[model samples]
Target chain A: MKMPGFDISLVIIWALVAVLVVLAWRRGEGRLQRGLRRGFEMFLINGPRVVVALLAAGFLSYFLPKALIAEWLGHESGWQGILIGSAVGPFFPGGPLVIFPVLVALLKAGAGLPSVFAFLTSASVWGVHRIIMFEIPMMGPRFAAARMIASLALPPLSGLMAVLVIRLLGAPAGVIP
Target chain B: MNALKRKKASLLSEIFGVPFWVFAAISLVMGVLTWQLRGPATVEAAVMGDIDLFLFLVPRMLGGMLIAGLVQVVLPPEVVAKWVGAESGFRGLLIATVVGALTPGGPMTSFPIVVAFYMSGADRGALVAYITAWSLIGFQRFMIWELPLLGPEVALYRVLSVFWMPVLAGFIARRLTIWTAPPPSEEGTR
Candidate 1:
């Protein structure tokens, strides 16, 4: 697969850095060096954890129970499916590449909108691997813990809200998987 | 001289910390499992793919780090504190919600900013709101991924229904932080 080494995202990031550098320069030339040094220190401190986390995520991606999720969510709807979706979200790892396709599969297989929305919400918010690999390492345990607990009810709540939405406006048409 | 050398060694090791070791152990086990269950070829492919991703992320993350570091130096702490500090209240959460939703890119891009803001006197509530907003309602992801894949109707409703999540989460986090032990501003290894 082709890697996006120099994508629009990277360009935007570099642009931000350029602007920040200019800001630092106006503050003082010493601030520029100081900022760069601090950034380098950050890299040294956190880079290894990032590398390990990536490796772990990559290896684990191979084992995601895609078929199992389809089985669990393919036929169910309503609160049960929503509950299942919330439970299953964290286990489905990887980024959009892994997630959206699974969602497409579930929807195509006749999963309900509320369940899928719940799945997406929890997958993004309570991502187990993300917490283990990035959040805990980068942001610390308290922040991670607090964030997790704070957002714990969101998936089901959103799922319930989606039910309300569908009742009022109707479900969107299924994807073309 | 010996003590200095020990301190340097400890710092080097400390940087890796428990998370690194735990992940290293998990990766090792997974590597063994992949080789056994799939094949050596699969293991090789996984490593190469991960390396490519790592390389792709390095530039962006470094840029994020640089911006974060520079912001800490250039932006006044009082400004950050007044805007997003514990005392910043609901309005602080609102600002965080908007900023977080607007922030583009992945965790590598966002987390560094979170660190910088935390160091610069932002409160836990605002920080949590920022992250929640970025995850749940980020415009970039919604436009690029959701609209294209799920179509506009579903995407619109999904967003509309859950738009207030960040502020709610932030509110909860604010109280939770106060109720619990205080989180330090420094980069935590735990």
Candidate 2:
């Protein structure tokens, strides 16, 4: 078991690339060559940044504290818990397979709904790790900075909204299962 | 001497831009620390893993760039502008949010389309909305990962809680861009 690197995503990329190539080919050789050349140049310029960023990401992933999840995000509710959730979200590493189970644990431990909302929102909005490894390298700094600054209010605001919604609907506060 | 130093700095900046150096330094420090503290084996594994990732990235990025370039040539600027341009307003934000949600794959896929649109004259507000929605409500993620792992009740609650984020973020980005003048370089890939 364990192929170490291969995955379905790679297949998806290949399919996508094939489709794009066909699309460009249909357009014309001039446009096709133009796109290919532009894409290569982009890779040349941004490739080093991406490589370094990935290296940094690899090192950073080691330091992510998985054990602290329930401790940090599982207690308290309202503004305090929500604040903690927002703060802790970005620090949690990996995708859904890695993060969701921890989330389920938090729910079982009776973590507050607002805090959970804030945590997920913060993770989605401000996953600084992804910002470094993917967004910054792909999109550039100004775009990243603008988006980051603009979205600063969303996490906690979402948490507050969650509190209101839960109260209005009379939903269970914790323990989903 | 100062003039020479300035020239050298400009050359480096031209090649890599400013953020590259920052990340480079961080990578060096992190790599060294990991090697010492966790032993060389861990560092080796990480390096190899990163190399594998880089290989994967190579094709995806190539395709991504091609899409970006071809889209510009294929799609008329007016169509892009009319839908997602600066003056497209709230409707543009809504359009972007929906598109973002629908977009499949990861950052490699989404960012290219974003750049394509940006170059094609899509507004910053719509771009922000698109990114926000991609990160926040990307339906593929929900369908593939969230529902299976977290269950329906939690997923429903979460959806209810944070659905309004993309539009809000777009509105803010729109207003912010109006106030601040973007640097000439901030325009999408030259």
Candidate 3:
């Protein structure tokens, strides 16, 4: 809930933006204006989608009981939990802001490290929303298809490795909160 | 030139064009269900909570967008492609991975950069590596989001486990591209 790190990160990001804006101004001939305009345009385009997505994520989180999620993704659930996590990843919408928090909640509710990692990997690698909206449209269907096909094994593979590492290192099986 | 190249589309059209509406519809259904199942108070709390999140997100989102713009202006596509073009090989893929990790913004920013690389003769493998690295291992995302939410240990393990993914995906993509490439034409009598 209270993320000091997020606040600090935001400050750093804004500082970087300030430096870049100054540099753009010095670059001469409408560069700064052009860049700002472009940035604003992007914000406008993405803002609505982001709002709807976040609200939806909130509702979804509220609707899905944490106990149920934990049960499905808990440590004792084993490889099945990992599989379910991976399968659910692509369908779990929203950007990092939404996804990470939901994941943290799941972890807090007793989900295993392997399942959490699998969910993160799959969501990042093969998010259906991203693949359809950005990849297919911007990068072409062929490129999207190739990348998806190539990444098909990554979620499970990452989960397997996580499980292996936890066993080998004798680490706690759940997320180390 | 870049200005002309930028696509012009309204927010409404873009939202409707994709499965965004589907997501919205799902959200609406979920909202109604929550209201029915958990009472109106729960729905109100969720909506209010999201509003708080939205306010928190605005500044960060804008900052990210500005950085994305600055990246576009400063790092010319030609320069990016030269460093990660076909001839750059494994080194290119490595550089792409690092670039992708460091490059800021979400898909809206990264995909255009990828398109630029494609036009500038960057290899498909490198492009794939770049996208994969950006999506899977972006340093900014890790530092800002994952560490704060997931904790250091989980984030570290996730990074370690998937660090090799981009290169592997790139390699596979390269092989697939070659396999799918059209066969060389036979010499024919004119």
Q: Pick the candidate with the highest TM-score.
A: 3
Off-target runs (Cα >4 Å) in candidate 1 are A73-82, A88-153, A157-177, B1-11, B85-92, B96-164, B168-190
Tens digit of per-residue lDDT, candidate 1, span B12-111: 8878888678878988998999999999999999899878756766675677667656765776544444455444578888988887886655787778
DockQ head-to-head 1 vs 2, winner:
1
Name the DockQ score for candidate 1: 0.40
What CAPRI grade goes to candidate 2? acceptable
The Cα local distance difference test for each model comes to: 0.74, 0.68, 0.74
* DockQ winner: 3
RMSD to the hidden true structure, all candidates = 8.8, 10.6, 6.0
Winner on DockQ (2 vs 3): 3
DockQ of each candidate's interface versus the true one? 0.40, 0.31, 0.47
Off by over 4 Å in 2: A1-76, A172-177, B1-87, B179-190
Tell me the TM-score of each prediction against the true structure: 0.58, 0.56, 0.72
Compare candidates 1 and 2 on lDDT and give the better one. Answer: 1
Each candidate: how many clashes? 0, 0, 0
Models ranked on DockQ: 3, 1, 2
Write model 1 residue lDDT over A96-133, tens digit each, in one string. Answer: 54576466546655566778888999998898887888
Clashing pairs in 1: none
